[model samples]
Target: MRTGPRAAAVVCGAVALTASLVAGGAGTARAASCNVTTGPYQRQVEQFLGRPVDGRQSAADCEAIKGFQAKHGITPTAGYAGPLTWQTMSVMLAQRAAGTTPNKDGKCPTTVGRIACVDLTRQLSWVQDGATLAYGPVPVRTGKAGTETRTGHRQIYYRSIDHWSTIYDVAMPYAQFFDGGIAFHSVDKSMWNPPGSGGCVNMRPADAKAYWNLLRKGDDVYVYGRKPGT
Candidate 1:
């Protein structure tokens, strides 16, 4: 993910990929047979994945990169150290830099009793109690291009632990509806998947479950920033 505001967004160029791998590790069968190709972000990805930072793709490097791409739902896993793969690494680094004080910038109001803050730019969400950090800075998938998640202040008006989307006919476990059909919910898919959610904030199952337990009906939900590609 590019850092800074949308106006000054920077796209990192990554190196080329030799082959395409599947979404899951099922493609592990061909890991050894992957052709070697170097990407611009090869060195960075290697460093991020704790592989040898030679800025070149090796059999081992291909396997490692493919595994990460698979886990994060980066399509055509392909063992390529491409922009998307590097962006995912960037997001992880940013999250690590956030540490516990996800509200350090105070973009999320501290005045609210207990607020769930969504930073769409960073694809991260966290809960705060007054000035105290209650949870997260966890990865999330927000609205995609056309169906961008609505911003501004809102509150949890309803919740359903075993909710299934009546509109999409998909399971949304631990759903906490804050804005009409949009909710904070758990998706079975990877949080890093591109094109994002259907105007809802999609979380990992564990994070959603934790939010369900920590938050209540009246909790504030503040969403801000523009999701990339929106």
Candidate 2:
């Protein structure tokens, strides 16, 4: 989609929640009905094209779909309902429906095994497993207007027992970072939305604990300025 500032922000959070599905080879299943109909996939295509996908196909639609497929390793073919095309479409739809977003920038590292890319725009993060784009929403606090969270490639450099007051009850050590003090820690249940913290990303206590258990001390965590493309 032609991601605007607002969309980009929403996508980032969604990625955090759906990242696991994208990473778990779930998108390979049969395409959901929503994908083929004028549902989430249509919405995404409309957004990406900056217009609607009428009965007549536009060159833009073809190109956009092709690009999307190519990125996900789908053969860039003519129709939009092939295995690869449908799978790609399914991931996009599922991500959005689940509150996940797409990343347009190719900045997040795809090479790191089990690494994930958080698209601040989509409010989602995704973990890759082969061609799948599993994703989920993860609440985070970006830097304030003047001190926005640094965008681009970064990693989980450390884990900390100490955390800011906002997420003190998370029960797990904060997943420390190479990017300032912005760590992935469990958040107080009350503060799960955007612009809620002093620029730190937040996750539900349960989700945070789950991640803490899954992640090790030095796994790669990429935070993107925009959502990473499927």
Best by TM-score: 1
* Residue 11 local lDDT, model 2: 31
Shift of residue 119 alpha carbon in model 2, Å: 1.0
| Model 1 TM-score, 2 decimals | 0.81
- Score residue 123 of candidate 1 by CA lDDT: 87
User: Which ten-residue region of model 2 has the weakest summed lDDT?
Assistant: 29-38
Candidate 1 achieves a global lDDT of 0.74
lDDT of 1 by residue, 73-126 (tens): 666667889887887788778778888888788898989689999999888999
Residue 142 error for model 1, in Å?
Answer: 1.4
RMSD (Å) per prediction: 9.2, 14.6
Write candidate 2's Cα lDDT for 103-184 as tens digits. 4345556666656566554445555432345444554434434335556666666655443223122232344444555556
Q: All candidates' TM-scores?
A: 0.81, 0.45
Question: Best lDDT goes to which candidate?
Answer: 1
Q: How does residue 171 of candidate 2 score in lDDT? A: 31
